[model samples]
Target: MSIVERMKNLSEKECPVDILRKEIAGSKCSDCGKCVFGYEGVTQLQMMLGDITEKKGKGTDLALMKELCALMKTQSLCEDGEDVADAVSYALAHHAQEFEAHVAKKGCAAGVCKKFMTYHILAENCTGCGDCLDACEEDAIAGKKRFIHVIDQKECIQCGACMDACDEDAIVRAGAVKPRCPKKPVPCKRK
Candidate 1:
């Protein structure tokens, strides 16, 4: 077959892969406020069960999906069902492994990976600048009236989005090497 034919065949045979990244790849539930509410929202479990059942027919198993969905419900959601279904899809496809690897509340209160959330600046050391906010992928930084910065622990995803953007050497990872995850699904780090 011609190369074009091969490519077309590949696309056709490909399993249903998400084209738009509304959620992380392996973990659909990233503990983001959106998912805490959206996927399992303030609805009856019966309704959630029905939706999961219909969605499962596509490939996911409904009962199994609900079990996982129940788990996500504990976190609180962003209150839009379809808004965050992709995260549920990711969790369905990849399971809890991604959750363990990426979404722990202890170190990553901001939902970003340790690898990404390496650096932080002591506020007293800050030089009242806005550069860090520009670099942060998580948008964790909130500059105060004096241009002092504070990291919003909840919204952070340690993608090193800020360190590269700082000029005053305010953000540093505290010299700890976050254990590298090898090919662990990037399934949404944080924020």
Candidate 2:
């Protein structure tokens, strides 16, 4: 039930004859004794699909890739048709986890996804800034009079509201901040 084997079987029994002929013209025909309908290599098929997608204006969309991967996870098909979809589905579903462990190795599940931000309280720097206290949706920041501003990591969402509220530049990001969906790092682990 490997995709390669299943693809050949499907191609032989269900694929269009014209498609098979085109594959042959591409000199990608499989001469396997058992192959009834020639099948181009899987990599070629991937490339061809890319070309077709571009022509159709369905260019690579990461969200689409994720949907396809997730669908494939529960999909019944085991061949190329099925595998490609599954790959996309899974990638989209867990793109965040995959991204975090990537070059950044950070997680923003608590709304604290960036490294440039962290939970902290400015002692002398803070003039008992109530702006942050008023901005805090979680009441994590607590102080009165001259008490320093403190951040409760256990509750702070890392929304950077405190950072924006702090006129004294007391708030900061914990580590390297990145987009919610990064495209520069590349998805595959090659780079």
Candidate 3:
């Protein structure tokens, strides 16, 4: 579907900022340097959108993006640039609050952006088998043979490797609100 269609029909699990970032990142608009608006404008949009998804958005990014998109709509040499500009404009007009939340470092409401998510090992579900620890390239998981594993938020890259390697589904991704897991490894509550 087009970016505008996807934006209008966003599911609760979909994040508008992240979605737009992906669309722009994957589009061919930046491949054409025939026009300054088509190339430079879309390139800037790609960078800004990327920063927003990565939680590095500046306070002035929204305004700058609006201005660039407006210029791209009228000055672009091809329909591709105009289409992308329209999609971005529509997203900014309708989902500005979501962009604001990302810029403010609040959190991704849809939990789609990995940067805004935290990994947690549910105390009730952890088997303490150390599979998660083995999967963690960052050594973010701490646990022993029979103790509940705890995730070190500072070290975790939020890669979801622990979640995937967990046979018991102990690891979970949390957004905005974190689960009440122990800060360090603790005795397993499960048998």
Which one is best on lDDT? 3
Which residue pairs show collisions in model 3? none
Better candidate by TM-score, 1 or 2: 2
lDDT of 3 by residue, 105-136 (tens): 99988888999999999999997899999999
Global lDDT scores for all candidate models:
0.42, 0.42, 0.89
Error of 3 at 177 (Å): 2.6
Judged by lDDT relative to the true structure, which candidate is superior, 1 or 3? 3
For 84-148, candidate 1 gives per-residue lDDT tens digits of 34344444354333223232222322222334234566554566566787777666777643455
RMSD from true fold, candidate 3:
1.7
User: Which candidate model has the greater lDDT, 1 or 2?
Assistant: 2
Q: Once superposed on the true structure, which residue ranges of model 3 sit more than 4 Å away at CA?
A: none
Tens-digit lDDT track for model 2 on 1-191?
43323334433223222232233233322333222222323333344333322222133433444443444345423344344343333333433353233223233233322332465653535666468888889887766544565676667766677778888765555434431322111222211
Order by TM-score, highest first: 3, 2, 1
**Weakest ten-residue segment in model 3 by summed lDDT:** 1-10
The candidate that wins on TM-score is: 3
Candidate 1: which stretches are off by over 4 Å? 1-113, 116-118, 174-191
